[model samples]
Target: MPSSFSSQMLSSGGLGLAAGLSLIVAIGVQNAFVLRQGIRQEHVGAVVAVCAVSDAVLITAGIAGLGAVVEQADGVLRWLTWFGAAFLIGYGLLAVRRALRPSAGLEAERAATTTSVAAAVSTALALTWLNPHVYLDTVVLLGSIGNGEGPSGRWWFAGGAVLASLLWFTILGYGARLLAGFMSRPSSWRILDGLVALVMLTLGVLLLVRG
Candidate 1:
């Protein structure tokens, strides 16, 4: 009986990890921001830390049943939707400006536009916190699914999800340097920034239209 229970818990944890990765592995605004910071090699550690820790908190909240609370908070969601849309639009404009500017090599541009650590951290926080989808995925969806694991199994499930977040951010932030050779050209930066702008703008507009 004990062994059977253990097998079920392991299965639950594996499912949690898979579900978390499925939701998170997409190329969204937060991922784009993290990739850019990683390429720039500016405060990458801090950015990764922020993202991982935020995920941990949210996942834990979900596992602890805060998801139900969030679901009932219509006013909070509305406020976040409006605020997030505004923030994304502003950030998207910056990306557009970067894309339009005369580009330099990635390293040269990094040197020229070296952002303060605090500023980078602030941007990371904003990117992680402002998006309503983050709440929905981490708190509502993940939470509801985790709660289905029953009390003891839910913690293991949350652990698996948190581990996924940590592994993903660490690999993305640190391993981004591997693409330095390809992203060395000035034109590469322009293309990347343009894509980032499009993503941010589209998400922002969608939030406004849908919300």
Candidate 2:
């Protein structure tokens, strides 16, 4: 009995770690925004913390059987995808507009001053919650994998997954910020914003068009 228990525990731990790592390893739009903000070295700490904490909350919710509820809701995924796509496209358009408009140094300073922690937190939450992929990855996929384990194993799996998300967002936000100096130029911002626009438009169109 002891041996069987030990074996089960080990298996569960392995499974949890695998599930956590697999989902968090992929780069998505949220990560891209975090990276961009980080590289700009603007609100580095706030950005990383908000992103990590938001992810932790979502992962925990998924583990708490939230996945089942989400699964039962008809058209939940489709609606989420649409909302996410719209936000992305709208945000990208704003970025493109900013890139096109060259602000005076005084106006730029005032703009920077207005970027508060609350705004950062709100943005992070929006980015995290708007994405339907988060639901599929955390709630459905991770939750399914975790459900296979025993009670203790479920916690372990959740821990691993949360750890993965926290680590990735934290690192991406801080590490990318180091590049802010290089990305500070108006031309650089323009190019970066343009790419962001393209990505948002593509993702939005794809989601809306998807049957």
Candidate 3:
């Protein structure tokens, strides 16, 4: 009985971890922000914490029945979708401005650091909360899968999923620092910011269309 239960738990948790990673590994707006912060070594800890904690809350909320609520509350999501679309587009525009502006790599990063911690934190919060896609992914999809683990393994699955979020954000946020050396060039910043702008704009337009 013990061995069977252990196997079940491990299998369920492992699957959750894999699923969570798969969903998060993509280059999205949120990840782009985290990577930019990480590469700049500016407010990385705060950014990573915000992302991990937000994921945890969203994933847990989904498991706790918010997924069902979201499914029924179409109006709520619609508002969020519009709000998110606007925010993303605005952020993308800012990225475009940065990309077009010439910068000396480290000099630009230093300038960015002058942006108060409060500003960085605010940006992180907005990027995390304003995105409706996060809800559909974490709350609806991930939550549904975690709950599908059956009552016995559901919590275990959630644990794994939550762990995955922590691990992913931690790595992405911190791992970006590895590229700090390469990103020291002005051209690198322009290229990265350009890609970020493209991603944010595309996603924002898609959200508006979907809404």
Candidate 4:
């Protein structure tokens, strides 16, 4: 019986990890922002830490049943949706401006435009928290799925999900440096910033229209 239970726990954990990765590995505003920071080699550690920790907190909250509480508060979700949309749109506009006026080439030029640590951290926090979809994915979707594992398996599932987040953010933050060669070109930065702008704008518009 113990062996059988262990198998079940393992299965639950695997499912949780897979689900978490599927949700998180998507190309979204948050990922784009992180990738940009990584390419710039700015406070990469701080950015990754914030993202991983935020995911852990959100996933834990989902597992702990805070998702239900959030669901009950429709007003909160509504407010978040509107606020997030505005933030995305504004950020997208900034990206558009950057793309229109491409900066100088490579790390030296990019470094000149590097933001302060506090600003970078603040942007990371905003990107993580302002998006309503984040709550829906981490809290409502993952939470409900984790809860399905029952009492004994739920925490194990959450652990797997948290692990997935840690792995993804770490890779994204650090692995981005590998692409620095390509990103060093002015044209490359323009393309990347342009895409970021489009993604942010689309997400913002979708939120407003859907809401």
Candidate 5:
């Protein structure tokens, strides 16, 4: 291919990546949990990689036809919304409590237990699959958007989204521990937990009302 063609392709990839990433940047329970995992340096690589791959699969499915299928399942969507709402609210309350009544020091002094790859994979799958918003974003919104791009852009868009998820997970998981070191203050964790709680509660309420 020509130099100009190569540059154009690269530019297209960048655009696709950005679009895919934008869809998932919202503050949600899944992300909050991932961030916590990242901070703790527990199965960071596996977690990130799983999340990324899950996104790619969903995005591809959405492009393939899952969006239409989901759209047709109105009742299922409502049920999912309710369940997700409950999870969010409950999670938020716990987070708020932790923030307000923080432990004097690290709650548990313990060696890091080894997490098997299987367990890591299961956790990632649960986080991705159980979260209704993942379907809403990946299958519904992203699918619609990717379909709009037509067949040619479909692959590019999917590739970009996959790459974005991969990049985000890798960076977040690996870099979280480094940040934890800097944010050794209990106050920092409190603030973070508090913010996550607020976001989750708000989102949950919104979803409930919307449903």
Candidate 6:
């Protein structure tokens, strides 16, 4: 490819990366779940892979014009919003229970039987797919923006988005281990679970209210 074309692709990819991260690097259920798994160090790889791969697929689909199809499905998203909200609220309550119970803290988490890989993967998928914002942000917003970058630029932008997803999840899922030592205390885990509970419940209620 010509140097000019190469430069354009690079620019597009950088733009895509920034945009993708902007939408992703926020306090969300997906990030919270991934972080929790990372701290537990159970099936961390599977969770990260599911999240990254899911993002790539969604981003690609959005840019490929499936976003238009999604745009026409307002009713479906509303239903999903209800379901997602219910799930988040339920999960948040579980987190609340975990926080309230000292036995459920990270200090004793190691002795607890880890969840199956299939269960982890399933939860990851639900967290990714259930959120209506995922479709609107990853598909509709990113799709429109990436598609506007022209044909070649669109794919380059998509590559950047996929890269961002991989990079962020890898960092978040693994980097959280650095805190494993500090979080070894039961109180710390309690606090973490409490925060998770707050996030989940807040997001859940907001989803329902917005819907």
Minimal lDDT window, size 10, model 3: 106-115
The weakest ten consecutive residues by lDDT in model 1 span 103-112
Off by over 4 Å in 3: none
- Ranking of all predicted structures according to lDDT, beginning with the best and ending with the worst: 6, 4, 1, 3, 5, 2
Question: What's the TM for model 2?
Answer: 0.81
* Candidate achieving the largest lDDT: 6
lDDT winner between candidates 3 and 6: 6
lDDT of 6 at 193: 88
lDDT (Cα, tens digit) per residue for candidate 5, span 43-127? 7777787788888899889988799999999999888888878877887897788788744333231122345778767856765
lDDT by residue for model 3 (1-211), tens: 9998999889888988998999999989889999988888888898899889999999889888789999889999999999999999999999999899878786666685467678888998998899998998899999899888898787778888899999998999889989988988989988999999999999999999999
lDDT of 6 by residue, 99-210 (tens): 8876645647756637899999998999889888888999999999999999899999999998999999999999999989888888888888899999999999999999
Tens-place lDDT per residue, model 4, 45-129, is 9999998899999999999999999999899999999999999999999999888885677765576677988999899899889
Residue-pair clashes per candidate: 0, 3, 0, 0, 0, 0
What is candidate 3's CA lDDT for residue 208? 96
TM per candidate comes to 0.96, 0.81, 0.96, 0.96, 0.82, 0.96
Candidate 2 overall lDDT versus native: 0.72
What would you estimate as the lDDT of candidate 1? Answer: 0.90
Task: Show model 4 residue runs off by greater than 4 Å.
Answer: none
Which 10-residue span in candidate 4 carries the lowest summed lDDT? 102-111
The C-alpha stretches of model 6 lying farther than 4 A from their native spots are 104-107
RMSD of each: 1.1, 3.4, 1.2, 1.2, 3.1, 1.3
Predicted candidate 2 versus true structure: per-residue lDDT over 87-117, tens digit per residue? 8777767766865776443335236535677
Q: After superposition, how far is residue 207 of candidate 2 from its true place, in Å?
A: 2.2
